[model samples]
Target: MPLYLLRISSEQTSFRIPSLLSIAQVFDFPIRFVSSDLFRGVLVVELQREDDVEKILERDILVLSATELFAEGASYDELHTELRNNMALFDPYIHTTFRITMESCNHRIPETRQRETINTFRYTGLQGEVSMKAPQVEFVIVEDYEWEVANTPEARYARDGNFVRVYFGRRIGIGRARSLILSHSVKTRTYYGNTSMDAQMGFLMAGQALPAPGKIMYDPFVGTGSMLYAVAHWGAYVFGSDIDGRQIRGKMKGKNTRPGVYRSAAQYGVEDRFIDCLTYDVTRGPIRRGGWVDAIVTDPPYGVRAGAKRLGRKEGKKPLREDPYLMDDGEYSHQKPDYLPPSRPYELANLTLDLILLARWLLVPKGRLVFFLPTVNEDYDEIDIPIVEGMKELKFGAGSVQDFGKWGRRLITMEKTALDDGLPPTFEDHDELELTKASGKLPGHYGFNKRYAAGFPPRKDGNRSESATPPNTTLEKREEGME
Candidate 1:
């Protein structure tokens, strides 16, 4: 087995591990973690082949770079001894045009010190041009130390006494994270809504949901198709449906200044991967046959920035008997009638339940469903997660939550574990979705929506709580609607 070192971007510290694990699962790649500290932003893993690194770089947006590790040790003397003992193994790279770059985490080394360290290996039969401009082979020497050492008087956490670990490797490849970020950037995007997801997060969702190429991914609440852009970029043909036609077709002004999701797709040269997009209320959207889509990825509205709405009629409303105008052909006719259907406030619980049920019916066995579920940190209950008979929760630990000020949205990833038997879940199995309670508490009060509106409650000292949780108090009564 060959060992490799992975350098991850420090941003999105929580999402890195799950993304790595999910990508590994997708490729069915057998990997063992050598350095497993998720927060350290570096990973050393054992893989069977070197080519698999390219496969991971293709889909993972959080990884910065990867290297084929050569030698590692807790001390410089040990590492030098290992390299000297294994001179035959180092002959291939040492004889080629190569450059060595130094990297450190939680510690900084001066250029003088770095050069001094490199001098220790320079005399060991190395016969390559030190090409600083363009090297045929690139080598990286990483020195990692704990932040505690940086603040202490005993600072130089080098390999002698205080350093945590040291790595020496041949740089193999860099991740496509920068290009992906620029590709779907909202700043350059032609059309987007207020609640449009960030490009980085959308790319992560695609990685978790559609992992492989040539899969069919569908987004039910595809407002502006921001998420679908990521899915299509991953080589999956994408389809999207939303309740608002205006969003699907960006509103036209005097000229064709603004185009919709398709225009954005065309801009990215990914129109071939985009199947189609439509405007339809997800609650009554057309049903797909069993095993229709490979994955379902979406960012459903939580009524914070965008209202959560679904199509339905008011109580006691009846269908019209006849149309107001008729053509000579005896057909109800209108040249350009702008008729819109009525919609009601969709309950957060019910909306989530519907999404799960839809996935249950449409997803192929082992197909994934990745979506964001907004939750106030205080009321977030892992047990309250929606239960579907055929689906299994995949990633639900720390990597899931992307936090804001006291409010955060959790990314829920589920896989269809079994075939749908054309049956509905029993009452006791899904009573959580129902808004009824003897206390007459509205559905919104118990979940993310209510917590968002109330914000973080004030402490006993009358200061707002900065922690993820609010003060331990019951929520006050409010209107029966989402935030």
Candidate 2:
């Protein structure tokens, strides 16, 4: 099987890789590895077989790639025509589709100084135009045989005929940029989390799970409704709940008022009536009218500052005496003043508990739950839930605490145990060391040995202890110390 590399935006790289792994797991394909550097703006996925490519390029899947490149002093139009002509020579079945687009670079090379040793030609075609600003797939052409110093060293370059370097691949799409723009657009006061979800991750998570249109899909902690929005756009009837009424109401209203908000759904030929949003506290009680959901896809609060905030003690201390939204006095501070008490302490554990409880109550028999959890706290125990029968963990994001605090998020997939099965396996008196040996750090915690091991060794410098010579010698030293 011929392999194809599926590229995604780097902004979405963390989630994207896991999403790809999840997709690979679902399709039973062996995912080699995920590479973010193969392309400048997108994460690259190398599929083991060409057949697996369709899983990602399905109608609901939003394809993203770069589209064009300019030779400093070359004729843009002539280069475009030449590239299109070259593409026409290749058999469609053998070659992947290439599109030409244009973009103006902030850097300029004057024509008078243009190098004649290498002929410069521009490439363009299905990839969108460059001037449009953000195109997913870019194209470049080289008509020179000599390779002058590569103009854009950061961009991938290849030598062709007289023009030795042609470069093109996948880039981030404008749809996401537009999403951000409209989210902050002045027409609405809707609050959209400025952070970008790994686009590749979103696509993989969505692509792997078979679309169940008309069947209800749930997101317990649907922050900004990103996951639900993606699923709904794919043809599922999405139902989402969050403790924050403002987010639920705000997103619902935004979707209803904003034109073309569901354009992806339209593009996928899905009906417009496939989404519903509401507010419910997962920890407090059963989700209203809760039952079996076809799938539960969500990016839950990852327990960092970026996670959802809880009312402070001062804010939740006093019950709402009246409607805060309607209060004539402008003393209200919280977004939903009427709902919040005077003061309360914000805790990430409490929020996690709420979401887990909600998942237990609402997930359909054998339903799938995809979530992103933070693993920064080594002391916290692995989440143990009775209903969850199996889980697949994926390590993602940069390892730094600050980076993880900002963008680090790991993915975990759980499936509800079937009724036919007896009680799920239970363990007693298990320690961290035993668990680490069993699961080898569970994907994301790659540095488990360093973090968890007791007195393993000094990591910074390879200095041996004066008394500790070797493992056997150390045992004798311990005995001598006992004497």
Candidate 3:
């Protein structure tokens, strides 16, 4: 195994380690630990080969770069001594055109100091031509400055002794898949709603699902096909089924009449992998039970932003109204092909439970199920995730919260261990987030707690900020033909 250094982005610190580990877990790559405190902007690991490092870089959204470690020490004097002690490490790049790239965390190293540092490492006895642009081999020196220091400080205050640790390595690869974050950004997309998944978060969610070439993926609560595009870019043939048809169909129609999801697929150059997004409620979903789909990734709508809805009545014993849904000839009006059905609020806990069962029935053995669940951050450090037979939830953390106010959502990933051989077990619903563990009275997640009622403040127009799932004017206009 070759020892490697990974320069991780400081953003989403909790997700960085898990993101890399998920890629390794998916690809069966062995990542042995070589450092103790690994998550602080720098990671040192022992990988099988350069190929394994590249495999991680292809899908990991948090890791910035991967390098082959040569030598490292706390100080520049100690670094040079370590380099000379193992001078054979520099033998391969001695006669080749090479360049040394200096990088520092917590403080910006001036170009003058950068040149001085590069010159200091010249004692490696490398009599090679210096090529900055197209180097045959590139070595990187990273300085891990004191984290307590003020971020974005003046370079004059950037002292050499301020650095806690330093590393010297040969640059092997960078996180090229990070480009997908910007390429599929919401701002750059053709059809995205207010609640559509963020590009970075979309990639993060998709990575957890372990999407790969020839993998069959699906998103049941696919809004505007955001999750679909993210998986499709990774060579997975992704299909999205939404309860609302309007999301699949373009809201805008005039000259270029392509639909939203499909149009975005073409624009993203992923049309080949973009399996059509059909309209259907997940509760009455048409998908057959089988070990077919490789992965299932989606952001199930919470109460706010995107109101979770399913086909049926708003509230009542019977699903239909008192008025007979039939024609003069006694034919069911809903049987008329163009008829649209009414929808009701699909609660959080129930939706989470249904998704687990659906994944158990639909996914192949070891196939992943990745989705989001909102929880009250103020209540506890961790929410009790859904526990079920044959559906194993992988532990990442309590929840990656980033200024989510009082409550926030976390991405939950589980794998279908085996086909359902027994009946679904139920438990007492003491907590709102506890899903399948339900037996007695079920008030549901958001209905009772009302944690999100004060989430998004009301707008001047009286309607809350959640305008994503608005009143359907088309449905309101169809009073005589309403479902």
* Regions of candidate 2 where Cα sits further than 4 Å from its true position: 5-11, 21-55, 58-212, 251-275, 288-291, 301-343, 375-407, 417-483
Query: What's the residue-level lDDT of 394 in candidate 3?
Result: 69
Model 3: worst 10 consecutive residues (lDDT sum): 473-482
Candidate 3 residue 28 C-alpha distance from true site, Å: 2.4
Number of clashes recorded per candidate: 0, 52, 1
Better model by lDDT, 2 or 3? 3
Task: State the displacement of the C-alpha of residue 61, model 1, in Å, after optimal TM-score superposition.
Answer: 0.8
Q: What's the lDDT for residue 350 in model 3?
A: 61
Candidate 2: tens digits of C-alpha lDDT, residues 205-314: 55434445566777766655556555665567876666666554444444465322233334334436446555554444244444466667776654333445443334
What lDDT would each prediction earn against the true structure?
A: 0.72, 0.41, 0.73
lDDT of 3 by residue, 174-230 (tens): 888878778888898877788788888888888888878899999998878888888
lDDT winner among the candidates? Answer: 3
Model 1 quality (TM-score) = 0.84
lDDT of 2 at 141: 24
| Model 1: lowest-lDDT 10 consecutive positions | 465-474
lDDT agreement of model 2 with the native:
0.41
